[model samples]
Target chain A: MPEAEAGTLVLDCDELEELAGALALGAALPQEVAAAQAHLDGCPRSHTDVYELATVARLLAEAPEPVEPPARLRARILATAREDTAPQDAPSGIRYPVSGGGGPVPGTARAPAPARSSLPRRPVFFLLAAAAALAALALGLWNLQLRGELDQRQERLAAQQRFIDAFAGGGRSVAFAPAPGQEALHGAVVRRAQGPALAVFTALPRPAGSDVYQLWAIRGSTPQDLGVFVPDARGHHIATLPDLTGVDAVAVTLERERVPAPTTAPILTAPL
Target chain B: MATGDGPAVSDPDAALLARLVTRDEAALAELYDRHGRAAHALALRVTGNAETAQDVVQEAFLALWRRGHTYQPERGAVRGWLLTVVRNRAIDALRGSGGQVARVLPVDTLVLAATDNPEAEAMQAVDGRRVRAALAALPPEQRDVVELAYFGGLAYPEVAERMGIPLGTVKSRMRLALERLRGSLRAWERDA
Candidate 1:
């Protein structure tokens, strides 16, 4: 990282343009490299200037006079490239089948041309069709990746909205204390002074097969069974609990299914 | 398919690049016949050793053969792309071998298709005589710094260190010399 202009932290347009000249050959002392890129990203004119200058710099790559290369060098390079056309067959995903540069190893043949034509019928047409299909496949995969990203963003947005709604209700939050040896679990019970309550958990251990975390409302000595809920892949669950009328506490236990009564000890407890 | 070291009139190089993607060895040979001398010259200039230059050129051609599918026509001409690869590989070899490059004026040419004059060739070769003449036209100091940075593959500061000049001087001289070269190439195309 070459130092930018001395005593200056931010570069102006003029300074960036001055740097663009050197950027042609990647000779710019861009300790301010990030700033230069940011400038190029925003300024179309300077971006084009840098590109054109780079093309000019590239021209310097040609020899003024010229010298012929060794004839044997040409033969060696072409032969090696032809051999490299074979697909490297690595049976184990963890390790390459072969290492180092040379001709194709045994058992590997140059990947047979596109699979569209076994019989040589209209070879050109089949080749074109295969190429078109490959291009379409690439485009489809790119679209699928974008859709996945969009879905994740929407999910995050919905989660944030839920958090905001809970906070805006001005409810008192009761922390759900985890049982000993299960400190990774955390939850909270949000209740308005006189309305419905909500239960949210994070890092909730996913129960074993055919099991769920059952919720119970404890009033005095009696425990009224609420319902069962499962956590998402990230070990998070949020659900609105039933009316909290006269309910002094809440408890959760891992159970095989919704039971009429408590089957085991509470894994989490929260006081109203 | 046209293999000759003459002026480029049509888009023949594009066909050669397409052939390269298909693993056609004859196309590779034809391309080598056309540009191998120039590639070798550039490599030798940078690495300062004929043997090292040969290796660099060979590696560059092999890389072109392997990575041809990744080329985007929108970027620029095939000849430009080929020479850039050769220059980069030579620089890499020079760095690895710790070799030194002697300073001289560096020349460059890119013939944009003559939009205004259809009679003009798509790419006019600026022969060695004209290239050396353009190099001679530059101020000695400006030309020297341009050669050191462009051919030596050194950063501006390194050019400064080698020439015993301030870093700013090296930067400005390089800029001027290259800008002038761009102008000269365009002017020569018009003259041709």
Candidate 2:
């Protein structure tokens, strides 16, 4: 084995270990590689070792080309875009025009209509008036129906907004209510946060096999695991997360316990 | 906020992204045209499948629409940032598809196979096959450690966790593995 000569390099086995650790992490320093290479020149064993490692590194840097995406994905994406733009259930409102056509221009030429001097019976006017009244009534009813729908939609939206706000605040406590006619779990908020510190909890169906629930705090660029908790026999449980400040979102996942930490991807998330 | 004469549109990405934020279908289509292929390629490489890669790319673009405001141009070019996003999304897809590790071939496979092509001019300078064969000759355990670290792009702690071994053991194995591989590759080169 070609060994590092006495004065070729100052690094010891422990130093080499650290270098290996860094290399394994893909965080190896360029200077370290150069130093190792220089040392290897005088030491045959070291030279061979460093060279092989370099080759492997080069190979990794130039891995095979990735697979191409299929064409159908574009259609799916566009469909989602269309769904997002679909109008909500808001009633259409009419607005009076503000000023454009100057009050009948005085100099504008007007075509004269042929004169109808004959005055029909008075009952004809009454019949016309009655028809107009009926039309007005129908219009009123249509407006009322639209107003009613708008009011209902507004109420539902307000309730949903409140729920989302409560979650964003990190409600103080959470409770899980069982879903109707189902053995699974449903979550609810008991107390809402004043700002962005609300506490929330959900009931998850008891995990089958060897799985546990993992909580995560996702902010910019990375996802941090909050912790793991197991649900009780009733399949209801609560896990308190740290402050939600600067965290863009939170999610829960059913993961294998052996994994120990939450993966970068989330399995399920509660919309906030 | 503006770069003169690079592209006709000022802050083209931001302008398009703002429209996307409002759920503008046309703007989204434009973005897809601009960076779709590269994003798809990255996703495919990381996920190792065409279908999953497509999903990852779509998900990544959707995420960009949802979170484009958070992007800071100071960090790097938009293309790099997008690539990073696609990479992460692909990795996430791989992880979510269950605990089974994605099958990524060792880099040596690419290098060695390249050398076999008769028309390749670059192969004349470097005997990539010999180097790859040398790597293959190592003990399976050591080879796996090296491959997972370098090609899999996994950190030491991750490799340790994946292999169910101690961190110290992983480091030692890597050092020994590299030393042996290097020795063998050098011997092959000299003999040739």
- Give interface RMSD for all predictions: 14.0, 21.1
List lDDT for all candidates, in order: 0.59, 0.46
Report model 1's TM-score to 2 decimal places. 0.53
Clashes of 1: 0
Clashes of 2: 10
What lDDT score is found at residue A59 in candidate 2?
34
lDDT of 1 by residue, A77-143 (tens): 8877766643222211111111001111111211212123244333456788888879877898889
Q: State in Å the error of residue B179, model 1.
A: 1.9
* Poorest stretch of ten by lDDT in candidate 2 chain B: B105-114
Tens digit of per-residue lDDT, candidate 2, span B1-192: 122111121236667776754556777777776667657765666677888878777776765554454444432234434554565456557656454422221212111122223322121223334545666887998878876665454556667889999877777777777667556645654666
Which candidate should be chosen as best, given DockQ against the real structure? 1
Among all candidates shown, the one with the greatest lDDT: 1
Chain B of model 1: TM-score? 0.80
What tens digits encode model 2's per-residue C-alpha lDDT throughout A1-272? 13333212244444654455334224233223323333333343433333334333433221333233456777787776555422211111211110001011011111111123354323446867877879877898889998998797667545544554456555443332222222123444334445333334433456555456656554432334566666677455655556665655565544444222232134344333
Residue B63 shift from truth in candidate 1, angstroms: 0.9
